[model samples]
Target chain A: MDRSVLSIIKCFGTELYNALKDAQDDISEIRIRKEKSVVVYKQNIPYAVTKQGLTALELDNAKNEYITVSEALIKDAFAQLCSYSVYRFQNDINNGFITVNGGHRIGICGTYVGENGIMRSVRDITSLNIRIAREYKGCSRKLADIAGCEGGILICGVPSTGKTTMLRDISRLFSTEKMLKVSVVDERGELSAYSHTSNGFDLGLCDIYCGYPKQKAVICAVRTMSPDFIVCDELTGEDIESVCFTVNYGVKMIASVHCDSLENGLKNVSLFRLLKTGAFNKVVFLNRSIIGKIDAVYNIGDIQKLYE
Target chain B: MNNMKIIGAVLIILTSWLTGIMLSKRLSQREELLIELKQLLSEIKRRITYEMPTMCDLISNCGTQYLKPFTDNMYNSLSGGYTINESVISAVADTPLLCVLQDCEKQLITDVLSSLGAADSTSVREITDSAIIQLDHYIGLAQENRQKNSKVYFVTSLYIGFAAVILMI
Candidate 1:
């Protein structure tokens, strides 16, 4: 790819990431104007292609239009795409978010019902944004030097810090170049949003287990999948303890965690426990600009050495 | 002589009127009580018809090998040990029949505690105490259910008896 094309691609990714991070409600549509073509993604799936300008639907109007997009159309689109439907778009006012096969994520927004500090589910889902997954060909090249022949690495950053994007790229690189068997525990369909036999990105030799609760999925994957490397995002609670225990079985893990800074990452009780267990061989910290710039990467072992 | 006769007539009228008011008020209070009792009895009957089977199942399951093994297996499966305690507590607390069954379980536990060595007695007592707490909760729930049902039955019978008396008259 030309350097200018690469620059434009980076810019597009940066802009989209920012928009997603700042999003207060569901993002109805994402329009990317490439040099050659204009691609419009609706409910995280690309819906239309045109050379001319298109009006992206506002949150409320988008929901209304989505209701009109018949269940038959949705089902057909999903079937043609080979993605299993996790949820259905019922009303523009309720039951809106849908999870398809292969870890592709779509955001749903409407009135919410919260009980006992748990989101039981969503209601009155007026808007849905289906985010298409695409793998950058050489996105992991920047961190290849730090990866150092693969042991276990932890990727830590705040929300929308390109952690999932980075993990997807690394998984792709590992599958394609290293020819390693990668098992992805995608709790939410983000990393490998492959649906209906078509993957948002080309993940070579990867077996993905999607929609399982994170810790349970990890344990199940470790037992049955027998992956060369297990990759997951957003570790929490006892998940760190489980990860520590799994390391004893000699399975390499690559996971991303949410944290603002390296100090905060260390201070996290779960993260601290995982570190103390000597499970993680490396930790990579991500820094991004307001426009999603790749600011810096740090070695976890190096940070530990400084602390010691 | 005229004044004395007027006073006597006034006294008689006052007595009769007071008696009538007292009788009417007593009857109204009885009617209210009967209505409340009837409501409570119907509620109890409904609960017995609908919720009793599930409660029976829960009680039977609490002591069965199937439930015990299932609980144990779930406990072992999860990484956390506290899961087992939580599950056991939840199962015991949620079952409607637990109030009655808990006392029986407690007696058994107490006997075991007495037979055990002195060192083991402390641990046994702790377990018994927890179980007793759960039992008490069930007992309270059961009493509430009984009160609701009994009241309904009492009111219904009272109304039927009153109707029969009226028909006889």
Candidate 2:
């Protein structure tokens, strides 16, 4: 077993830890809220952990199968996670989460402490959401045939649609085999494949700018790395300006954005304007229902369906 | 043979007197050591707040030579897979001076070390302040004892040795 899993298991008692281990492969997230039954997720399906293992979603009933997280457990886990120095991670906690050693992000939910429109701290944390990081190698292989030659590709999908995973594999494929100059702007250290063991990390000749904001990292990666391709996970409104900058620099870029429908994605005025300027050639929509299947491929400028 | 016997008796009395003085000397040293430790805690708190160095770095640089063992114990425990809180608490709780320290003093040191590096600026200040106050109280007591009872131990030891010699005679 990976040490990361064991580290996470330390937060749970013996029984819950064993149950989680049995279903570790299927788990995408483990939610531990105060006085609530532990919620486990496989893809998008929620399951309350039973004594034996994961059973069907049974939240309302306070049964023996369910485990309620205690304040003491959270304290122990947080202290261990911060290496027993909470001061070191105060800023991270104020931001509502801290990414652990294995790139697993533990989102903190607590009362916010702020002054003058700036967040000062978070106190009395009551819930934690642990998002387990996993790499599905070759998940982006299908996009290679179509959007391979496109200048800038944007993968659109809702949450849990595997967009980030797909982007990670594509970077792997491009850098390892083809030996393309690849720079990844891994803002949260999520997409760099840094969390994986030796077997999982085949980033192969790619440069990763981890934990930098998307805009700054993208520009820095372009100027310093001088890569043929730059991969960034998740695009937002603030990213439009830098994406345009990368486009002008003639560096092919791949980024993911959260939007279920292509129409909704293009509805953003800045994104539409950028698309109209011929910045991106292809926008691939991922259908969560199909799980990694492309819903449609729209060619920019023409706004024509290239292929479905 | 009489002169040699006299010399031996004088040597025996001198050893007893010095042993009594040693106790007083140790108490004074302990008082000084506690003061130095409070200053070191101040240094650590300052560094943690502004410099924000790693725990290992903080431990190494927080103390003078006198406090090296305290910091060293923590640093070594960190490598031995103990949490910072646990390691620090163990060092103080298993103190070499546990036999000498009051129960409250031992508890204060342990509590401070356990929570020192794991709090925000405000809370860290509170922890250090509390520890320093406790140390100050102990230091005052040590100084008082050094003044009031140093002569008592010396005189008591001399008198006892003289009586023992008289009885023999």
Candidate 3:
């Protein structure tokens, strides 16, 4: 079991903690909603938590016995997540999620309290989705060649297709195996999960910039760390300007984008713009069947010519 | 026989004087503790305005000797998953030095601690500022009591001792 996931489970009610503790290694996500059955997702399969153990909850079966999450449980979990100090997590609460010490991102939903149309905080929380972070050490070994001999590679995949996990391994391999100075711009702290309580995954020889905005972190890394390559997750349209600017500094880039298929990836304006900068020469499509498996690798020029 | 009587009279006066000093020190100690609390609240306000440390950091890292045990108790209770109010109450009960505080003053301190880490920076600043003012009032009252009664305790206890000695003689 991931130590961070275990620490998180300890924050739950005793019964829930015991029920989930034994199966934490295989569990990926824990969905907690107020006054509802707690659901744990293992290998993308949903199971309702029961005292005996995890039971596969069927959609048509209304009589399945499961522990229903209460308001008190939700309140206690929120307090524990905040470390009993709500003021410390106010900014994260305003953003609708709080990342715990081990890089597990907890998605929070609640009534929004706003001032001048800007969110100040969230109250009366209705649900929390705790996404566990798992490190697959050799997950990117198959892509070691592509990761190492890269001008730039755009890894595209849908949500839950293991893009982040692949990125983490590739980062570790590049830093340790290839003996390159790699910088991970961890905007959401997911990549590094560096907190006071826990030092997250070992991305060997990689300099992690946690909780930095992607563009700013890239600029800082180039100026300060002088890393051979910069890796970041989930680039959107807003990052195009900075990414393009950073690539001009002779540093390589490895980034991910959200696209379900190769055709749509070429159609993505941000991906097109990113490729037009000549930063990325190849696009690697990841498959959901086996995480980190490259479905196809396309040359940017060939794809452009074919599409045109 | 005369030397023994002189020694006994001297012992009575000294013991009474010592008792007076001990009684006066209690009020002074309360005054000093109130002053420390005011300083702590001011420091808390400054940190909230500038550094914005979490409650755990604020309490556990506070280096003041008098409040160290008190804050340590609170820190342990919070880490043990106790509620804010419960932590403060437990800390107060566990701390011997805080027992010097009057009931109302302790209640005010409890309110200040309970309110912290439960709100935003602005609201927390306001709470600490308010707490500082109330602490200042308590300090003033304690100071006045110490100033007014310290001499009386010494003089009255000495007079009683002298009367006892004279009657014995």
Candidate 4:
């Protein structure tokens, strides 16, 4: 396990840190709620974390024995996550999560405070769901040849199906191996996680723009970086115009969307509009059981035919 | 015997005069410290309002050496994994630069440090503004005390030394 990943959970204090330290390699997510048993997901399986270690017993049965999260722990962790500066992360807090070092995304649940019926920032934190980011180097080797093609690729999958890992690896491969100019617009800082204190993940010659909104980043990359391929994560409805603009500007895009099947993927208004742009030539769907294994691939023309 | 007595009298007067100067200089030093503290708080308020930087970044970028001890302790403690409140409290306690502050002034500084990053920009600004006002009050008091008592201390000590010397003679 990377030491930085373990260091992030240290804000919960020493007891939880010690219990999770040895099992951190397999840990995928940690869910913390005040006055609730601290549950950790190990390779997609939930296990209650006790003072001794991870327990296989169900949370309800072992509630007495499990290490319960406290309000103090949550407060301390929230402060630590903000780096002792609430004002600095107001936007991230308003968005309901903050990406910390090592690219771990902590989903914050709290009371929203605002004025005149407008939602502003979160306060009185009650729960935090930490999704641990893992990098599988060379995971996109199978898709490397397809990535070298002239057009773009759209990756689709349910949550935790290795969409991000594939995008990361493909970016690395194209930038370094194929000697192509790749621009990664990391909106949430997860893909690159680059910070002042950390170098984050090695994307192999990719020029990363961290924390830029996807649409803006695409335009900026097209104008400034002149990248052969513009890679980003999680395309939404607001990005359709920019996607078309970038595709018309003659830059290939590699991005991901949340979908289980090709039919369901087309149902997404934004993804459907994206396909209509003729930007991506192929849509790659990932399988859940196998992290990086591609479940299906379809040509864009075929998808367009199916949609019509 | 007359020469010895003259030398002794000169020595006593000189020693007492030096003591008086030292006492007056302490008052001046206290006043200067308060003034600097006020300036520091104002700078912090401006930065918090404009940049909203982390506490560590704020202190590191402050670029003033007068509060170096406090800043250094803050940086080390915050980096050492202490919570911001704990780090601020410990840093304030450890810094010798803050020693000149009276109980109320010290409490004021502690409140400022403790509340700096604990709230939103508006709230932090409000806290800092309040602290700065209190600091200004203290500065005024210190300045008044220095001006009023510095000469008193000097003259009283000098006269006492003179009286002792005359009696000895």
Which docking category, incorrect, acceptable, medium or high, applies to candidate 4? medium
Point out the higher-scoring one by DockQ: 2 or 3. 3
* Candidate 4: clashing pairs of residues: none
Worst 10 residues of 3 chain B by lDDT: B58-67
Q: Each candidate: fraction of true contacts kept?
A: 0.00, 0.54, 0.49, 0.72
lDDT (C-alpha) at residue A216 in model 1: 81
Error of 1 at A260 (Å): 2.9
Superposed on the true interface residues, model 3 gives a C-alpha RMSD in angstroms of 1.8
Please name the candidate that would achieve the greatest DockQ relative to the true structure: 4
Residue-by-residue lDDT tens digits, candidate 1, A103-213: 434455546755687444453334344443445566666765666545877777765556777788778777778888788887666677654434555666787876566
Point to the candidate with the largest lDDT: 4
For candidate 2, what is the DockQ-based docking class?
acceptable
For B27-136, candidate 3 gives per-residue lDDT tens digits of 88899989988887877777767765667777776635447888889889877878778999999899898877899999998988887867766678788888888888
Displacement of residue A212 (Cα, Å) in model 1 is: 2.5
For all candidates in order, the CA lDDT equals: 0.50, 0.75, 0.82, 0.84
Higher-TM-score candidate of 1 and 4: 4
Give one digit per residue, the lDDT tens place, for model 4 in A1-308: 67877888788888888888887486778899998888888657789888889988584653488887789889888888888888777778878998888888899999989978866678789999998887888899887665456889999998877888888888888998889999999989999878878899889999998888888888889999999999989887788887898878999999898888887877778778889998898899999766778888888988989988
**How well is each residue in A76-175 modelled by candidate 2, as lDDT tens digits?**
7776776666776666787788766666778999888877987766767789888877677877878977887547788889877878778888888888
Ranking by DockQ: 4, 3, 2, 1
The TM-scores of all predictions, comma-separated, are: 0.44, 0.79, 0.90, 0.92
Residue lDDT tens for model 4, B55-151: 8888777636447778788888988888777887898889886776788887777778877777777777788788888888888898898999999
Off by over 4 Å in 2: A193-202, A269-279, A304-308, B1-14, B17-68, B75-84, B97-112, B121-169
